[model samples]
Target: MPTTHLTPTTVITGFLGSGKTTLLNALLRHPALEDTAVLVNEFGDVGIDHLLVDELDDEAIVLLNAGCLCCTIRNDLVGALSDLRTRRARGEIPPFRRVVIETTGLADPAPILHTLLSHEALTDDFRVDGIVTTVDGLHGERQLDQNIESVKQAAVADRIVLTKTDLAGDTTTLRERLRAINTTASVLEAVSGDIEPAKLLDTGLFNLHDKPPEVTEWLRAVDQDGWSPDNGHHHRHDDGIASFYLEASQPLAIHRFVTWIERLLETEGERVLRLKGVLDVEGSDAPIVVHGVQHVFHPLTQLSRWPDESRRSQIVLIGRELDEHAVRSSFDAAVVG
Candidate 1:
């Protein structure tokens, strides 16, 4: 589809001391990442992270200082992005196809997501490919148990990477805890964010090809009756984490679908951690994949090829206190007659 032409930008985030910077440094050296630009956010006035990268002739790196890029520092983000475009136009920075944003350790990624989703000019120029969150395997369990922001970070991740796995005392327990919080997120291991860079990027929402067979099967396993509160298989934890599937057998009316999504944002915006799905619109032959963080929704990009023969609309939602029954009811009610 024409929409597939849009280049994907990956946002890498994690709580403080989660090894995000280590991952970015490692990724910068990857041969495949030659045509990539790295955007870094430093929590203080001194920006030394940018100086740490060993610059190659093919890559470009820029750092945003001090303020978090989401709110107080958003204007800086806009200016930097604009500067990147200008440099690309003037042939200064390498002709990069991908952009990576690395937020500070304490940053709440939702605001950064908002800038990418709600900014008019930025949306036209870039598409959110996916969000990759690094969790400190040793401390992640404790963080999730005690920290609300940490819970939010894990909930919104497209890929949850367990960093510093070598130091984690009980890897299995940590993995189990993460799964309980967000069952649909792909969990990966990274000694020092040293895994293959290709695996970390470009896994757009509903890109079944990138998912393990079990995940693909999980998404396709949605019940025909639609999501309901009584489903015994659905899981939840005390920290407001819940997982459920939503499916539509028939192609959805575009306007109705949009309206239902808006209603979702209005009702449980803050609690919604992450949502991803493939929708077969009523009139469009190609499938559109939707991705969102909290209330911020990325532009739906149509796929060039159906990942497989299955064309049914399916979505996986992971959130805090998300009411599956209410969400399903609203969607069903919004269906065009």
Candidate 2:
């Protein structure tokens, strides 16, 4: 069950003044996020900044800080992840079931996601479980307008935590802007970065034991059999990013669909921000779930059975300036054969 049971690694990122730190601190304290290794820029928090005693074995990775284990990213995320795995296997450090990485405010999340998905040392043992972006509800709209990085962060998010919403009066415009960028992402409000850890976990297909209903909703556009926005938002995307689903009722040849995905990623990976779906493969009774970011993808999750009676396959793509007709025609060609 190694393939099915890989450790979930969620990247938490947002722009300056976006409440990312507040959210990270909140999430790290929760019992739900326990047994996790948190990688941060600096051990800035009081209880977590203490140095480990050499008698503990090595000073490279620290543990028992706060409730969960801790490691300093310090600018080397790949090194941190690789080191954690090796140390965990050797019993040099406390075992952690999952990982949570907090990116710098100005950093782009794609590189961390790419490393999680494609890095040789970590790919097999870890999977890109989710991307949670904390947005400053009061000023999120301004940040999105002024910062391309903020736009991309929100565009590719799985769960958008709108922090300080209680104080930000009338957030209708901000929500609409977010909806336009990523219609599929679930938008949750957090007052002073107060949000449940359970809402953010399992954004991808992992640790989904007996949660069929939730997983089914995760696969976008349940009622539609054709192209549509996952959320009920209908607006032209002036920012050049769009999210749409391609659906088919009949089972698809897994090989063909996968081949198309590979070529798509190879050719236009940078433009493709996120890809997710639940598929009814030709030979399989159970549904196969797909999740990816940029050029890399998670090992497909083959469920025990269809989440619901809806065996239809729907592939959701969120990207910039995607050629909808060409993509759909190509999908049709794959299905036709």
Candidate 3:
């Protein structure tokens, strides 16, 4: 009578030549992604070896040797997504549990994300798992400075993958630049598109069946030195775009917190590239996790216990041209007022 499964979707984005397709190609071959449906900007860009993949129909849908489905977003992403659902419904396609949308290097991810958030049909059937942004280690710093699009890509990432590390020739500077832009996202090192798929996907709520390894990784990001609200180092940088951490030792009043977030998003949604937190909500022994990209908020997750020893409310806000002092003050005002 009703759908028992909700598809988890991940958006793989990066600037031109960031190795997005290379990463996707590697992911498709992994056994972990066998049930994944991949939507790419162009079929030729991925360059799936003809011997390994077989075309399913004239519509350019192909089934990979590993049992994954690959298709191109011809024009309308909404139409393509709807088609996938319809085909899955009628038994015309594989039962894909996950969907990965790989955007072109030149693309801005916000509109693509907005589609997922505002589209009623897609929202009802799927959930925003997380965003995985690939960064070109060799040229990322220059790109970040020259291209505002590149900056936006790095700002909104849930996981930042550093590609071409072998050729980058000491990426400490690039890595630091990325971290300065986004502290909450885990930056993974990758050489030639090789990485554990499990680390990239399944970043949502914990599941006994499929425990995500990034839970600990995310916790570690928050527990880093000098990120606490009272610390002078609460904000990571002053480069127009920066990340700041807010911690409340006391449990948050759920209603007040939600109202505060909604009000803030309504006004500053465009500036808030990313927001994530592990909250200590009043009257709840469990920890509540909240994630937001721009104006869209994911469904909150309530974990049974603290992932680690620190049980205080921890929130990481990453934004562009944001006023950290005012934000910190507002956070305090919202929590109490």
What would the per-residue lDDT of candidate 2 be over residues 40-145, giving only the tens digit for each residue?
5421122211111111223333332211111123225555677888888999777888887766455545444444655567777889888888887766886687
Give the Cα error of residue 198 in candidate 1, in Å.
2.3
Candidate with maximal TM-score: 1
lDDT of 1 by residue, 1-337 (tens): 3446555778888865577766776787788787888888865444444433444332377778855664367667777777887788799766778788888655666556656654666766777788888998766776677555576667667889998777666789888877876677889988856989878887773243443344333333433323222332232124465556677888888778877787787778777665666788888887776755566565676655454477777766667688889887777788633
TM per candidate comes to: 0.59, 0.52, 0.53
Candidate 3: tens digits of C-alpha lDDT, residues 170-223: 999888888877777799987867999988988883221221343334334434
Off by over 4 Å in 3: 1-4, 42-75, 205-337
lDDT of each: 0.68, 0.63, 0.65
Worst 10 residues of 3 by lDDT: 63-72
- The parts of candidate 1 lying over 4 Å away from their true place are 55-59, 205-337
Candidate 2 error regions (>4 Å) = 42-75, 206-337
Error of 3 at 292 (Å): 35
Q: What's model 1's overall lDDT?
A: 0.68
lDDT for 180 (candidate 3): 79
Residue 173, candidate 1: C-alpha displacement in angstroms: 2.3
| Model 1 residue 269 lDDT score | 77
